[model samples]
Target: MQYAIPAPPPWWSRLLARMSPTEDMPTRGRHPRALVTPHHDEPRPTLAELYRARRLDMVRLALFLVDDLHTAEDVVQDAFAAVCRHHGTSLDGLQDPAAYLHTAVVNAARSVLRRRRTARGHTPPHAGYGPPVDEGLLLAEEHRQVLDALAQLTRRQREVLVLRYWSELTEAQIAKTLGLSRGTVKSTASRALDALEKKLKVVR
Candidate 1:
């Protein structure tokens, strides 16, 4: 998966100005919140490696939310930028770095949804997808169906579904990510699932 990254102006590029380090996350066109490189310092490999590790999964998660392959990249860039902004201390203490990145991607997608109420065009369905092509994607068809079902949902529903089924985050985690109450997360996820179930039955 990937996080969101910002794009520079086309005219600026003509002057050949220094560009920020671009870690390719799957977000389409924008990045926000990643800390700018320190004026006089090289980032260490450990942190770089950690970011590299999380990028692809973040991309996948972003793709899930955005649906369009193009926009997915933009969404992830924004997420990573956000991660950079509040990248407190180190990622060393987290029990699961992947989970952290996963949440980040989800949050980024939500931000995108807020900015643009609807995602236009096709977002490839997660649940209905064929087996993952990369060595990384291990989702089965049934699982794919689950993801597909989630994809059919509105942004809020998709966010709740990812928390409940994909990330297995607690209702509290879902609430915190979506800025909803735990009760709301629980209720929304329930409703989203009910909606997904109906959609899945028809497709199946």
Candidate 2:
């Protein structure tokens, strides 16, 4: 007698759909505004405007890296501070402030992780707060499960996956952010997705 294999759950498909880059990503018109370079004629946003727009997104990105909302906020704060120190509040003479800030946030998150590793007496923050809550994005049960699976991945894998899917960064941008080659970023993301899918399978 022949038997059919069990299909993956609906949520698995949803998860992949959410994680995959949009088809329009290859088109210049559909690129993320933050990633796109502004034309000379276009008005540049002030530092405050950029902060208001990107702060929450940056915090979300950091939360995935550090695994704590409070610490993530701190990391983002430090990133802004570093940018201001180097570029000033006016953001004068910087051609790509958003890109610069993206690199700063990634570096800041790395620093936090490094410090946590070195501090012998470091106590992880309490888990009472639970998975991160965002006004615009609510975490469902399956998505929370995915986050749990993500936590099991290596640091490099986690960074590659998060930056690729969550931040919607391209391979080149992820490579520049993590100081890895584009090929490395591509391979790591592929491996990371395979690992993540396997982990999710066990849960499903």
Winning model by lDDT: 2
The clash number for model 2 is: 0
Off by over 4 Å in 1: 1-49, 85-104, 111-148
| C-alpha positional error of residue 126 in candidate 1 after TM-score superposition, expressed in Å | 23
lDDT (10s digit) by residue, model 1, range 39-88:
22433223455566556556655765765445667787776666556663
lDDT of 2 at 161: 81
Candidate 2 lDDT by residue in tens digits, 1-204? 222212334654586455333242232233336433467877666677668767767777787787776788999999999988987887767787777777898889889978876673455555233444561253456667877788789989999888877677777888888899887887787777778889989998
| Alpha carbon lDDT of each predicted model | 0.55, 0.72
Candidate 1 Cα deviation (angstroms), residue 186: 1.0
In model 2, pairs of residues that clash are none
